[model samples]
Target: MTAVMEPGMDAVETDAASSPYQGYVYAYPHKTAYRPLPDRPGLRGLWAGEPQRALSLYIHIPFCEIRCGFCNLFTRIGSPEGLTTAYLDALDRQATAVRAALDGDARFSVAAFGGGTPTYLTAAELTRLFDIAEQRMGADLRAVPLSVEASPDTATADRLAVLAERGTTRLSLGVQSFLDEEARSAVRPQKRAAVEEALGRVRAAGFPVLNIDLIYGIDGQTVASWLRSLDAALAWQPEELYLYPLYVRPLTGLGRRGAEDAGHDPAWDAQRLTLYRAGRDHLLAAGYRQVSMRMFRRTDAPDTGGGDHSCQTDGMVGLGCGARSYTSRLHYSFDYAVDARQVRGIIDDYVATTDFTRAEVGRHLTGDEPRRRHLLQSLLQADGLELAGYRQRFGSTPAEDFPAELAAFAARGWLAEGDADRLALTPEGLAHADAVGPALFSAAVRADMAAYELK
Candidate 1:
């Protein structure tokens, strides 16, 4: 199985859109088996020729004190016997292997630590992880956008100082909802005061960016209550705010308990829209700008205008189990088993070499692979690919490649043509992004179906 053909390949499949070599659509193996699995359209390649200077890296720490019912992230409740320490050791090994694979003096422009809670690591573990990153990837430890995800409970002043010392400028605090009842129903026990304290400490530590993660349409979440939460978040004035509407996953506790009623459905969806509209208005009024579907920022950050292209365009190297990495033409991710033995096995594989074979790439990105790639790239920033950049990389025009779909989206006010090189999704598009994100998976799923047939 060779790489998928670009427009120039004469062997282009006539029914590429309908091709059978799509990506896997099952639940990400490491996440909660209790929630419904979200659609994941995989990528085409794995090993890019060589590492580039503008790369990004995301490291996952899949450990949490208590697993939230709504969370599908790979995590376990306070694994004893020092599993966290073991995971850190495993991560350092994986980093070394990844460095070997990268093959050159590669420097990363952005690095983000996301997980059950990266702050769960002890200060020593965190420092060691950063040391591995600095030594291996030559990552710009002093970059402006170095971000990490932390829960309120784990984000102590000590942790803030540790992060600041490590050149971490951004902190994404998971606040979920301000309502205590809503928080309890969602199984997130962190108190609102804790979130505020964490934010205050991080800001006082001089971290440049503070982003809060908020959710609307949770069980017992009414529009009025949702507005109050927003008001509370606004009072803190985080540098950025990311809003997510809760989606039910069949494999999560919420799913087993039929938790869709918590934050999904048209009515809940409408409430979220109202929240966004009001929230966007409020943020913009407060002088913040919309950058992506769920992202808004203060004027200080680069005017990506809501698009965080650095992650997608340059590609990212992910550390930690169940983390996904993307390169110029490939996306690779490994699963982490919750059980101790499986965790060790996966970690061993990480330390060992990973040969992303042609068959694997074929299974992820083939058939209508290019278009799906285009969509993912565009959606990341709520803006379409730069035409010149796209041509330089993928060698085709999206309008020419997916004429009907693009035209239909534009007609429905979900998309708009930007400069010849740019395509930006409209406000309408942002409102229904969740649904459309799955549409982008069409090609991936179709390819998966084809693969299933072959099997």
Candidate 2:
């Protein structure tokens, strides 16, 4: 079907349709804007005075077999000899220091391994990765929900088995497209049969939840083709499906090509919108429900954010150079790098450093940024935000805290005054999530992000 006007395609959708691609506001106050901390705050103080909130741990694996054309995450295409081992060793040291800094009564309810591709490691390396997390952080993989990100090419049987035995609750695979051409256009080299094999392996491994990821807006994609890929994934009956809109960013393979090709096309935006609606409607009909704009899950699947994630209140403990640790007022990580040489240099520096007890680079949230963060995270969910809950946490209603912004959303008919004092997205509002999320960022943060150079 051709892309066309639909309900909720108001001025915002019109705006999206006119622009090249609405920026993906994954995390508010983009990491690009983060500056270095000269004092390099120590972890003991950050973790000691912290409230008794359940904590989530994130372990980053910065190695991948191939860098996709549309990818811009902090990871390298390949690992050199002994690089993985060195990286793991550094992780062990960081975790030990970080754990020592934490209060003894700290509780961990969930853990995740994310990166270029956690599955890129050998089975033995994978086991060691867990060792650092479990031994250093005292996070028992068997007790809490554990999630790991992987790619189809590297999800070997050995790695899958190790993950299963170690009690990984969720295994997410990036099967961007079933069509070989689409996959090629995205600069991800993989065969249909290989992806099928990987899926079968992951399922046989018996992780409670299996999430398959698909991308909708590649260089060459259409309504029928998008459905073909979606239908293929649904046939697998994955517990979760993440529909990602292809984003071309600077320093990415696709970004360079996109620069040379058609610079900006609103028509592409409309096509993506049409495809998104088709996919969302199809998933709902197939007994899957939306958790967020990008996330859908089978009705029978346990809550995606079942543990500490459900509270959505936990701060994350990040290990590895690409990881970011968070606190109530701050978020910090090692400097970020997209260039291969610089990334290697940063990784080498991290591995060589003896001091792993403190954070060296970060940004502090001020004014109502914390409140804004809570609202942004909550409002983006399909469940919406509760006014009483907001008041209880921040002592202010969403309407009062975000008076002008909420009013605009309500006036546009994108937001609804739901039952029990909840504010939710109308069908159209959810469609424009990419735009809405960025609109909520504070002026100062935006300015900081604009000024800072994204490595």
Q: Report the Cα lDDT for candidate 2.
A: 0.79
Per-model TM against the reference: 0.80, 0.93
Q: Clashes in candidate 1: how many? A: 19
Query: What would you estimate as the lDDT of candidate 1?
Result: 0.61
Candidate 2 residue 207 Cα shift, in angstroms, is 1.1
Local accuracy of candidate 1 as per-residue lDDT tens digits, 227-312:
78888888877788877656554345575687634332555556666766777777778778787766788766542222243543
- Minimum summed lDDT over a 10-residue window in model 1 is located at 1-10
Number of clashes in every candidate structure?
19, 0
In model 2, the Cα lDDT at residue 219 comes to 71
